[model samples]
Target: MVFSLKGKTAIVTGGGSGIGKAISTTFARQGAHVCILDFSTDNGNNTVSEIEKEGGSANFYQCDVSNQEQMETIFDEIAKNKTINILINNAGIAHVGNIENTNSEDLDRLFNVNIKGVYNGMKAAISHFKKHKSGVIVNMASIAASVGISDRFAYSMTKGAVLTMTYSVAKDYVNEGIRCNCISPARVHTPFVDGFIQNNYPDNQAEMFEKLSKTQPIGRMGKPEEIANLALYLCSDEASFITGSNFPIDGGFVTLNN
Candidate 1:
């Protein structure tokens, strides 16, 4: 029970699928009342149902993290009845292109979801945490933020901003019992990755998947549950001493990869 989140109310952005879904379910299993904020009501509701089936408490709120008004409205509603103790900024979109190939539109789209989305979530959660004098924020960054990766100009930029924002928020709110940190994972294996390969490499999805997996020095992509476990630990009371840190859960991609 060292990492117990009993009686805690946790909010996870993009909790419908991928890493977000994993974190949501994991947190719920740890006894937290989880609120999933996702754009896809179907997926979000599905996750909620699954949690309920497992005897865990959860609710789904349809939302787009990029829209400040929508986020503010939903966060306010959550705060009405529940004191939110944790926020996971895991909603983000992927873009594949270097600076020249990435047009202004692409950059703006990435900025809105990846960068501004984190900002919106943090901004909304900060007010609640400020009032309570305690909160934990776990942000999902990417190895792209620290290492130079080809064809990921915009993504790298946004994740880099996430890292800094984690630092700034943690430093600013540390005295108030608020802790902020980020996790950087390299190529997590999710449905999105499978779909990406199937759509882009219809004739050779398996081959492309293998190629992508080998890109990591560990010879395989990270798992969504693995990332979730890390997030759970970071958000728990056991991590009280942890803040303003960026944990790279990459499969040796940051160090061993040449």
Candidate 2:
């Protein structure tokens, strides 16, 4: 029963696919009533179906994290019926380019989904957490936030914001019994990575995949489940003493890259 999330309610943005999906299912399995939010209705519902198939409780909401009004409304609605105990700000988009190639439009897009999206989710949930005087917030950041990553100008910019924001929230809400933490994952093996490789290196998919996998000192990309496991621990009661912390699950990418 250690690390159990039984009777807790969790809201996971972008929970339809990739790391989000893994986190959503894992939370549900740990006895949380998972609320999955995603722009894609199909993917969201599919995740719900999978959770239900495993006898886990889950609900799907079609959501766009950048839309502030929509997020507020959804959070209000969920709070009316369930006490949201965990909020995972995992919705984000990626762009591959240096500053020279990352135009204004790309920067704005990243700001909207990667930076503003996390802001909107937290804004909607913080009040409830404060009122309840207890809640857990886990944000999904990237190693790019802490270390220099080539061709990730805009991405790194937004993730850096996520990291600092985590600290701010945790510090501001610590006395309120709310904890906020972030996970900076290196390259995680997810559908997004597969699609990126297939689209950009279609002719040399295997080679490109190998190259990307080797970027981590572990000799392979981290698994979505691995990230989810860490997330689960952070959100569970076992991490009660933890807050305002940045856990880098990067497989030495931040330290070993020289």
Cα TM-score per model? 0.99, 0.99
Which residue ranges in model 2 land beyond 4 Å of their true spot?
Answer: none
Please give, for residues 122-228, the per-residue lDDT of candidate 1 as tens digits.
Answer: 99999999998999999999999998999999999999999999999999999998999999999999999998998899999889999999998889999999999
* Shift in Å, residue 119, candidate 2: 0.5
Model 2 scores worst on lDDT over the 10 consecutive residues at: 249-258
Candidate 2: the clashing residue pairs are none
User: lDDT at 243 for candidate 1?
Assistant: 97
Candidate 1, residue 210: the lDDT equals 95
lDDT of 2 at 21: 99
Candidate 1, lDDT over the whole model: 0.96
When summed lDDT is taken over every stretch of 10 residues in candidate 1, the lowest stretch is 249-258
